[model samples]
Target: MSQSNALIIPGLKVALVPCPALGDTTLLLRLAWRLQAAGACVTVASVSLASVRSYLPGLNIVGGAPDVVALAASNDLVICAIDWQVTVPLSNVAYLAGKKLPRGFNPEQPPVLLAGRVIAGAHNVICRDPKAGKTMVQWIDLYAEEVLGLDTSLPVTGLQDLPAVAEDADRRVAIFPTTPHASKNFSSSGFRRLARCLTARGWLVEFVGIPAEQQKLKAEYPGCTVRTFTDLKGLVDFLSNCAVVISNDSGGGHLGSLLGLRTFTITRRRGDFTWRPGFNELNRVINPILSFKWMGRTVWRPFIPLRRIVRALADVKVQ
Candidate 1:
């Protein structure tokens, strides 16, 4: 097909099936922007309502493979953000019948199998090393300009349109203190201590989480302010106006960094660190100083001290 002809296909549609987690969806959102810039209409397809809302505003939620196939039939390009193993059968069947199925995020080299049929491969923007993370972000920015044919003049304020706390009060601090898993959760006692320390430092701490988590944090933290956020807008608003954010290795930490907030993240050694957010120089990561294997197991042998986290927080600069 001619380049202009491909660009003018009236029914050309691109579908992005984001991973189950909110962070993955957020990454996919960046890709969606690039795809849209490439002249393909993009729609995010997912199963989680909250996940869909967090990353994709007008998502097409699907219940099963049949629904996905139906959606794929009408589209010219489909990017599977979910694990390739789960979607390989559907992708193969679709491709055999002349549909485009582009694979996403393999650690190895890009496959030559669907050459020309695939719009882009997933390995282009993923990184595990901290230094490479910055490179990956830069590559994505370039991809948006070069491959996607987008202008380089667009503003790159990450998540700036989302709702946030109303004011930048000097005394307010946003404490994003929850994780999706128990292993990543800091000790409640440690959190209470941290809250009291921030309060003593004249910072009014607000705990942000889902509704149920807000209730739990309130019961645990007593005097701390608790806010239950329903959408990405609300979360962004809260993070944007906060003085600083102390969170686990969850979506909150990523959101905090994206909003230019000073962020401190507490993560277990075993948690995935490949996609950690880069907040210029204001973000800190605290993990147990133990062997890699020790951190990977669910239970730990207490290789690191809580004092290290306290010291790290103490060293943070408000600016």
Candidate 2:
């Protein structure tokens, strides 16, 4: 498992296929940045382009496996972070799956990433699921260091690496109180109250979500500014101008962390360590409950006091 001699060639073409989830896509950016920094051409292929493309400004991204086939045909390597039903006809494929928690898994340990059977007859099937506590970004870093033999000790990217956006003169806090799953979301009332508290503190508060949920959120938080975007770029541009991001266990937190913005991610499960926004040192994960189960709805989401959230926001330094 030692990668002492493994080295990436300059101008090497690589295609990375990550899980379609926005958080997963954001996590994979670290690996992509490493590859690109080493003079390797990196492209991310996923179905959730609208959710991820905004954050991936410089990296090339294709829609899915269909688009990847032509691109991978010319690329030197193709790495997949998820199990693919359709295989790319490439000789040098790597399967990097099983990074998420399994059913009835030990809540105290990191999720296991198994190098299952090769899907596209891969030459290099590399995965390392050390039981040690690690975040999703760290898991990818392990894969790069141990599997690909790449040096990942130093920080790969900073705010200077991203395209510059003029910061707002006023301190703006983008609040994303929604997640794909209802169980992961804190109560709407809790979010509304949090927004009002920020407004009272002379901070500009805004609620962000997809266009489909725009009307609903506006109705829920009538006084607050509810902004929606149809594409990831719009959201990314909006987030770039903000000072801090407060969100549920969702992509908003992940995106904010990737942008090197101070993010306070509210979670229901302490076991979601792998899913936390770990790219930034200033990022904080606040949990209302300890258990990572159905009790999150009853015991956790319903009881997240506004004071706790305000306290968490004030605790972090803005630098």
Candidate 3:
């Protein structure tokens, strides 16, 4: 808590609805931590409710799109992410805008119908399109300073503290080989290579994914432990005991980083650097070997070699 707590109104209750994605929801945890530190009671709602609750058990969490008007009435302030597509009034409500609208949501006419689909009439709107250039963390810092009257910088802290289960906790390493976007994932063979290397050194390697991905992961990494979590609490509890986590550019890396675990993120391109996990000092981003524009979009080819990833992991003395 580098910033002075005086800037925020003590005991002010706030309700927040973050964007739909798990990664997007986790990015707001920093802001929630700051608010809680200042004695402000914070409630967060997201599609990833179970995951959020697992990461920060201290905060009040609800599921799905809550009634904004009802929340605004109960809480002192309501901060809704613009991606929710809910029209809210300007009074006592602020909007946290994200990168853009959901994909494939285009109106026939920009001026007439666009106004209906977008979130407007908010007294304060942070992270709008003009502000999208900054990284999500940078946007949150700005929100704290300009909106909440906090210090320019603050020490990064996990929303909750998790104690290691036992002496063998450091011997465990969890690898997440899946991402919502297929292109963003590191190669399956690459993860297998890294897992085998770690296993040879007596490090216990495990693979985690959703229930839908469980069978595929088990088949891909035979002879290795594959644990599928129906609930995020189970997944997070499992991760808390692990020493390190390796993941593609997805929610798993973000969750591990939020839990203060050493995380290695495999990103598809250098451009995705802005979205890399950053809460923990041990967090690192691994990018592809080369990237070039193919058609209208950039194509990141041939994920980074296994040797380089291994070298990066070795750089950190995780014990």
Clash totals for all models, in order?
7, 0, 0
lDDT head-to-head 1 vs 2, winner: 2
The best candidate by lDDT is: 3
Rank the candidate models, highest lDDT first.
3, 2, 1
Clash count, predicted structure 2: 0
Q: Give Cα-based local distance difference scores for all models.
A: 0.55, 0.67, 0.69
Residues 226-309 of candidate 3 have per-residue lDDT tens digits of 998776667777888887889888878877887778888877645336676766677777776777877986666464755665
TM-score of 3: 0.80
Query: Best candidate per TM-score, number?
Result: 3
Candidate 3 local Cα displacement, residue 59, angstroms: 2.6
Candidate 1 C-alpha lDDT tens digits along 234-291:
6665666776777776777656666676667776643335445553466766666663
| Global fold similarity of model 1 (TM-score) | 0.66
- The list of candidate 1 runs beyond 4 A from truth reads 1-12, 46-66, 83-165, 169-171, 270-272, 279-281, 289-319
Per-prediction TM-score to the true structure, in the order listed: 0.66, 0.79, 0.80
Candidate 2: segments with Cα more than 4 A from true spot: 1-4, 46-58, 63-68, 87-90, 98-131, 154-170, 289-298, 315-319
Model 3: lowest-lDDT 10 consecutive positions: 107-116
| Candidate 2 pairs with clashing backbones | none
